[model samples]
Target: MNSSIFTPVSPTINTSLKPHQNPLILIDNKRVACARARKHVTRTKALFSTTKEIVLKEFHQRRALKIISGLQNLDKYDVASVVIAADKGGATHVDIACDPELVKLATSLTSLPVCVSSVDPAAFPAAVEAGAVMVEIGNYDSFYDMGLTFSPEQILSLTKETKTMLPTVTLSVTVPHTLSLPDQVKLAQQLEQEGVDIIQTEGGKFSNPSKAGVLGLIEKASPTLAAAYSISRAVNIYVMCSSGLSSVTAPMAITAGASGVGVGSAVNKLNDVVAMIAQVKSIAESLNLSTIEEVVFEESNLRL
Candidate 1:
């Protein structure tokens, strides 16, 4: 068992009394009052949802590695190899496109939970029916190149409709990193209110910031990180960080407050399946170590 990886977070609160108020009365003060308010609302809804058994279970019990398969015009053999490697490499879940045949093939090849991605709400139920353990509203990264835009209202509506349509199946709604950081946070909070099981943050198309090295990495990941930080603080449900993420950047993601991280180009671009799995495992290990270290350090300081 990883002691550091799953340590519970301690809650901290600071309060001050206003001179104008009764001396005995103290008011709570925090840097992010709105976030706390949102969290309260989300917790209430989550309680209700849990009572109904609409809980979103994390598939990756140890550490999660979600292998993305089936790129544009890719062959079935290639997809099969990816699935086989994912299974052998200890992938927690596998994500495939909405193609029917590919879903069938993936399910037959790997017992790992399978997730299917599509932008249309109409495709969600069908994907679930086809044995997708989870469904995501994504591939907008590819669509953004063609001048497509996904608005907050549109995303909220899709989430509501999807939940109403498939109450049993888990739904992961992708928050477009294309939106401003505030907008991303707003949409995330709204999604939680609308009964979205998971909120996945993405950032590939809005801009490419990796060529500039460290500064590039910061620019590329900042939006998604901000969204993760804000949304995770505001909601108790899972938030999966993604887009332009590599082994180097994955740990930064956990530090920024993501429940899990998703990778595609880093793993998919590799020709060797074993290398991909190794990279994924390495990222998960690093996150566990970092988390443990932070917890230990905080405890030591408090004792001092």
Candidate 2:
């Protein structure tokens, strides 16, 4: 057996009167704080895989675009098309169903970080082992269509189980739009306390648009937008505005304070892979344009 690699440090304290006279020289608080900051950065880098760190950086820049393959979608060809679109279209990552085979297939298709989504905590470990860089607790729209709903307590329970299983893997949990806005904020806060890396908001299934064209698009996105606006304020973690969003509302999501946006039906519903790529590229370009406009507006305000 090899010897242990632990190195022990001396514990002696020098209590001379001269040491007390120049305490700042003996212990520079600024240096200590900076060291701690560097350690934190190192720890975060270690916690997430390199691809995940890149995704998080995009999130921090408020420009992350995640193309989601439905959680219930099992068709390999469909998943492949979606993954290819995300990669060619400039999305930061792709979210797919929590199946190890799908995880493997998605990884084979794109260099983007693959995020697996499921309400079942037990399903995440196998997917993570299969090469998924991140795990999500929901894309609860499918469950809603089945007339099932997730309560805040149940969501918290699921989050706890997932963290226990994969403590270091990046986690994103969706806040169901079925709950009241205040309740959504409360759940987001609790998820943050549980160390969830991201919070996603959804509301398309519940929205009933009253108009067509751009007005309809805005109407469809209102629920998720509201949830993003409310939950982003309530939690310090990044919020991803998802469900019912289009290129028209994608920029609005950023303005609503989301760190990023997740597009699913908007891309995945397309029968042609080329159309899917076009849609993804459109949303990505919209986000970029929005970011530039935000910068210009801020500069103009400063000048004023």
Residue by residue across 121-178, what tens digits does model 2's lDDT show?
9999899889898899989888877889999999999999999988878899999888
Query: Can you tell me which runs of candidate 1 are displaced by over 4 Å?
Result: 1-63, 70-74, 210-219, 288-304
The residue pairs in collision within model 1 are none
Candidate with the greatest TM-score versus the true structure:
2
Candidate 2 local distance difference test against the native: 0.90
lDDT of 1 by residue, 1-304 (tens): 5353213322221223333443223223343676798999889567545632422343222234566763342468767767776676555677778666778888899887777787776876666666676777765766776788898888878777777876656778889877887888888888888777778888754656756876776777776777778888887667888776766776677777776677776666677767766765665555563355468899999999
Among the numbered candidates, top lDDT falls to 2
Local accuracy by lDDT, each model: 0.69, 0.90
Report RMSD (Å) for each prediction in the order shown.
19.5, 10.5
Steric clashes per prediction: 0, 0
